[model samples]
Target: MPIDTTPNAAIQRSLRQCLSNAAFMLYQQGHVLETITIPFRGLDGSALRQLREASREWPACQQVLESSEAAVYNEHGRFVLTAMGRELLFDMFGQGAADCA
Candidate 1:
């Protein structure tokens, strides 16, 4: 389905949910290499794409970049979670699992 462009409360909530989903997806995959722009597959892309589609709803999600090796993007493509991103992901998954249990 095409994402709604019109701004509303639902869009705001979906945007936040998408961010949380993306963060959790990345965190579950764990920090492997050091690259923000790694070639992601599976759920990772879905999570990110969902957020991307809702970019207009939340601009903050755009700031959340993947961490990489050498402290910057380089030819050695490998991606890891940033310190802040990891913390956010941890909190998101932790709370989610706790709530489910």
Candidate 2:
């Protein structure tokens, strides 16, 4: 039998919200300064898979992260943001706040 891959609406929203928040936080803390894949942990299998798969498409969420003010190339295997990413993070956070509604 095949695994049911479809994620529920709540899970999908949660995933996007989590990723946005995580990226913003990482930017604020200066952790993400390069292109890196955040270790797939903590999230459920579906969420993780969604992120992985989404990266394959154009203009991905990771791309948003990379395009931020503090983005950089991932020499190490860790999700990072460059200087621009940090600035962009502030913007993203601000925008995300509005999404809370």
Scored by TM-score, the top model is 2
What Cα-based lDDT does every candidate model obtain? Answer: 0.39, 0.42
lDDT tens digits, residue span 45-83, model 2:
344354465444323554544543233444543344443
Candidate 2 achieves a global lDDT of 0.42
TM-score, structure 2 vs. true: 0.31
Over 1-101, each residue of candidate 1 has an lDDT whose tens digit, in order, gives 88666755565455446446544444554522222323231224444455456545323444434211111222333233434444434455563322122
| Backbone clashes under 3 angstroms, per model | 7, 20
Candidate 1 residue 51 C-alpha distance from true site, Å: 12
Candidate 1, residue 91: lDDT: 59
User: Could you estimate the TM-score for every candidate?
Assistant: 0.29, 0.31
